[model samples]
Target: MNITESIKFNKLKEENEALKEQLEMAHYFNQNLGKELDKLKQQILYKEDFDVLAEMYYDYCLKDNSKYDKLLSKEGE
Candidate 1:
């Protein structure tokens, strides 16, 4: 290949590697954020007020947490 083409190819390779590294870091960060959010949610459920608990329960409903209904049932019982 010509000198110019080789330089362009190297630049492209470097960019691709940088993008891959960035993507991996983003995924790792998102995963950790998700875990931290879950922990914060648990803390909220235990420590926060009822309105916050209700919102958390709504989110739990989307996840189909069966414990929510059980808790409600026991409350009514």
Candidate 2:
């Protein structure tokens, strides 16, 4: 292959490798988030006091808006 062809091939290969790493990281993050959500559900399930559970749920709900904003910005990128 000529020098130009070699350079193009190397660049494409690097981009592909970077994409694969990002995908792997995303998968790992998603799996861990799922585990955490499941644990939170269990905590709510095991809570005997209805008032405490409700308060916890309410406090957690307030964070949803910020989470959505971050998700939107990430998606836009």
Across residues 31-69, which tens digit of lDDT does each residue of candidate 1 receive? 999999999756533212444767867754336646443
In TM-score terms, candidate 1 sits at 0.55
Candidate 1 wrong stretches, greater than 4 Å: 46-77
Among these predicted structures, which one has the highest lDDT?
1
Error of 2 at 7 (Å): 0.4
Model 1 lDDT-worst window of ten? 68-77
**What does candidate 2's lDDT look like per residue over 1-77, in tens digits?**
99999999999999999999999999999999999999986564222343466677876544354533332222233
Residue 51, model 1: lDDT of 47
lDDT of 1 at 28: 100
Identify the candidate with maximal TM-score. Answer: 2
TM per candidate comes to 0.55, 0.55
Q: What's the residue-level lDDT of 31 in candidate 1?
A: 100
Candidate 2 TM-score to native: 0.55
